[model samples]
Target: MSVTTTLRPPATNATAFVPSLGIALASAAAFGSSGPFAKSLLEAGWSPGAAVTARIGIAALVLLPVALVMLRGRWHLLRRNAGLLIAYGVVAVAAVQLAFFSAVQTLSVGVALLLEYLGVVLVVLWLWLRHGQRPRRWTVAGIALAVAGLVLVLDVLGGMRVDGVGVLWALGAAVGLAAYFVLSARDDTGLPPLVMATGGLVVGALALGVAGLVGVVPMTVTAADVDLAGLTLPWWVPVATLSLVAAAFAYASGVSATRPLGSKVAGFVGLTEVLFSLLFAWLLLGELPLPVQLLGGVLVVAGVVAVRYDELTAPREPDPAPSLTPEAPAPPR
Candidate 1:
């Protein structure tokens, strides 16, 4: 629709902080809930590939009308941003899910998750190396604490068994996760967040479906009922939640959060998804987390707070003064 959008510049201020944090947490909660629902589907004889593909496909269809409305009949918007759409879909959406699912086949969920969260470190490294956006000392400290907390939360030390192949796949997913934050935080892209989310899901769904047909991953599904939230419900309940709450709302809000929170801070906020997942599993499935895990959650929150504090307190580079327009005879002398 050629709707001009203005971007928030520089860093987050005190006034804008709450709204950004709220949206980020909302995204994390929505995304975290997907774990239990997806788990239930798997227990009900749905392959990981099938569950992911269906979730993405249905979410895309659900968001299509809204995305089109945002597009406002500006066909050129798609043409101009095709590369971004494809990359977001392929790397951030498809690759992340595919690789993580594949990794879990060999590795324990906790270990695989720890490895994938290495994407946080990778994000820091990428910014440092690629854009020279070196992390402040506090940012680095927060990252270390967050990762250490993750190890505790995931009980990675308790499961020292490793598979070489799964490590590689998880690392690949880490890259994909990094791509997600990097792509989402970009302000120069003309595409709206909802449009980008929808397009990425569509592309990811097609890619995974093709992989399934070629036998790269299993595509089996069953009509059996599943146990979730201690209730035996038809398989569709989890499926619907995964598509609507997890994929649609989660991705849209997650994408929008990056515009204000920036990539690094948003990644820090994303670490909370693990905490939310545990909370959901406990509430919905009656599985309580250990005391140590509760401690880990606190550390994770501390890490996020540390990063937010740094962003607000850090000194800003002063903006350059504007040049006077052709004031001195357009002097090129």
Candidate 2:
């Protein structure tokens, strides 16, 4: 999405602002936990595809009732927005998670997250090239800084050997994430965010199931116990956590927060997921980030902040003129 397209117009009412920010942060925290939890399952011999399928599938089941209630006889909305729902499910939900999980099999959680987040930059480029929306100066600077930070985080100059397959998977995840932002920013459908999120999860889960059944992606799971924070627990423990908190709660809260925060600010706020993921990985998986990588993370946050600042300070578009229908003649008088 272009900077303009991504940045929502300022909220006229300030009353709901704090609550929205809280919800967004909560969503980030939940999403941030996914990496560590999923990685734990992977370590216990679950394939990425299987883990993600289970995550989305169970989460969809959990949210189905709430979604139905929210529809409240407005069920036609689902039918009307089927195409968008399918696109959101397959690309944004299924593809993104699958790619990221696959990448994490070979990459560190923090690194994988940072790579996936490059999708934000992809959004800017896609908007510029496809829509001819030139980015503002701040966006340009943010992109430049983020790119530099990515290089540092990857340690390309350090010649740290990385898996080519993992890199490809991470990039794929990035593209999927960019598609997510673009799709979420669209307002034509008028579908409620909660409904959209719930439907997307259900469709995405079904798609993953079909993919697994077709043998397109490996689907493997283990009954073995999983390790978490120095304790060994049944395999289902992490799976339940992943399904409920990371997938269901995270997606729901995220969609709700986006409505109030706007796509750009919400997206920038989502940068916290990287940090939260890193923290979780360290605490749960004993994978601490290096000093250089931490510095690079700082730069990434700064870049996003600058871009959002520009969006906030940008001039507002004037309201359109009222319709000019001619007045009816006073025939009765």
Candidate 3:
């Protein structure tokens, strides 16, 4: 069997650009809802570790068949990029969930998210350092404004004391997430996104399973007391959905989209996840941010815009070949 991979060429046409934006927005929406939904599970008495483990474990299972079908003709790529793929799943997907859950247990969902958005600025820095081009002055200014806005959003100065270990975990999530984008953009040796997606979740699930077995995290589940809108449910159901849909679909789509949207562009656009989460919370839980947090939210958007203004304004790169020539080869020397 043969396999084909789609590499993300920069989008130049109006049609392509619009679809990328829509995909990115949809991904953000799915990811944003994860927090509140996960919170419900935790409130139902699932420990953070167990909840996170279940979410990824189930997601891995859901994705396995898809990966198998996609990689059926080309299993060799898995061996080729095994290390990078596994790292992406473990660090980016698994670590982010565990950290965010811990953060939300102590901090409000909005506040925890506001801190995680720091990854945007971190991505800007990563691009600058890795590529030797300074982010535009506007981008710098936006990052500053956004960070300041996050302080306001998080109310870091208003006697907000973060849990030390939790804070560390959240920071780790940021680092892992940034690496995820950078690495996902690298070639996966022509593996399909489904294959890459499956491979990552498998590695993450295995690692989490081992941790559970070693007593680092408890794997046992028992029914807990909780009621939701007149529905009786096991505590694991919500967390499991979070893992399979929110985290799995979200991560796979987000990672796969990197091929169509460059890493830097994807990072900037992903800021929408915060807004989506806020909207979900408002609608689902009737939870509204305080007036101060609202202002902070605006700053976050402004900051992201400022940071990304250059790419938004810069001319798109030209396509190398005509679409009609599907088998276009490298120009002869």
Candidate 4:
């Protein structure tokens, strides 16, 4: 806990920037792999609820032993951070995945994802209004470019007419996405990234399971083999990838990256996941992206680099020196 607390202050150690960036990009790649794998299962008769629940649920089971090992004799830390873990599960995990699935029921996946990724913008706005961390000129430019690129990347311009209910669901998911970065960046909870990731997976799995049982989310699954690319593999292959790589590794690495990068830069870098998602989809599902989408991916990368550059180059504000004596009280009116 102390290590997380002491090491997480933004820009505290300039030497760590590049490695953290690498880890962040790796996390994005892992997250991006989810779509292609999930698509395979869905095509094989697995419902969205079943896919999402199994992704997080089996991931929770896999990580439980590791979390317990890390938390040896630190039960007090878990007790103290219970609310944070619950919020992480509900907002960052369950709401985000569930709402996205709901939106995709009526909107094209690209359109639904575009709407949900509006959370990147919400992160900037939330920081400006809530934390008074106004963006400088460079950050503003980065945000603008990132958004324009996202439009092209998703090719929402060529999208079909969307349902209002689906739009609402995507918007709700946007809020959850914002919570994901904000909560992931928090260091006050005194819990390690692994613990946070494991707890979130557990809580999210439980919440989604309840929804499935209550008829809120449809739960259908099959034992049919999944056809990924040209190969016929067991259904468990994609399921394993979703749970282990996407849910477990992605979240653990993402949480670790946010500590050094802070929420703003980390959120921008996270845009790379869209590009990776397109890449994986093309490779595994034969969904090739248009040239314009490729161009958009370039812009997204440029924007993220700009934001990271701004963060690294920004002047550090040193802690004020401790006063030798108390200042005199101000004169009363």
Instruction: Report the number of the highest-lDDT candidate.
Output: 4
Q: Rate the local accuracy (lDDT) of all candidates.
A: 0.87, 0.79, 0.69, 0.88
State model 2's lDDT: 0.79
Query: Residue 69 deviation, candidate 1, in Å?
Result: 1.4
Residue 78 miss distance in model 4 (angstroms): 1.5
Q: Give the root-mean-square deviation of each candidate in angstroms.
A: 4.1, 3.8, 5.9, 5.3
| Candidate 1 residue lDDT tens string, 146-261 | 98899889888887658999999999999999888878887777788888889899898989888988999799999999999878999999999999999999988988887778
Candidate 3 achieves a global lDDT of: 0.69
The candidate, 2 or 3, that scores higher on lDDT is 2
Q: Model 1 lDDT vs. the true structure?
A: 0.87
Give a tens-digit lDDT track for model 2, residues 1-333.
122233344343457667877888899899989887887898899998999999999999999998889899787887877878888899889999889877877876546766888887777777678665567898888777776666565554565346889999999999888777676665556677778789889999999999999998799999999989889999999999999999999988887786666555566667667667767888888988778868867876787777767766667678998879988888985
Model 2 pairs whose backbones collide: none
Judging by TM-score, tell me the better candidate of 1 and 4. Answer: 1
- For model 1, where is the 10-residue window of minimal lDDT? 1-10
- Model 4 alpha-carbon drift over 4 Å, by segment: 1-8, 12-14, 318-333
TM-score to true structure, per model: 0.93, 0.85, 0.82, 0.92
lDDT of 3 by residue, 1-333 (tens): 222222343454567666776777677778877766666766676677777777777888888887888778777887877776777677767766667766766765545665676777676687677665467877778777777777766566664656767677667667766766666665546867666767777887787788778887665454784444345666666766687678778768876676567666677667767667767777767777667867877887787567556666665558786677577788989
Clashes of each: 2, 0, 3, 0
Q: What is the overall TM-score of model 1 with all chains considered together? A: 0.93
- Report residue 231 deviation for candidate 2 (angstroms): 0.5
Return whichever of 2 and 3 wins on TM-score.
Answer: 2
Please tell me which predicted candidate would have the highest TM-score against the true structure.
1
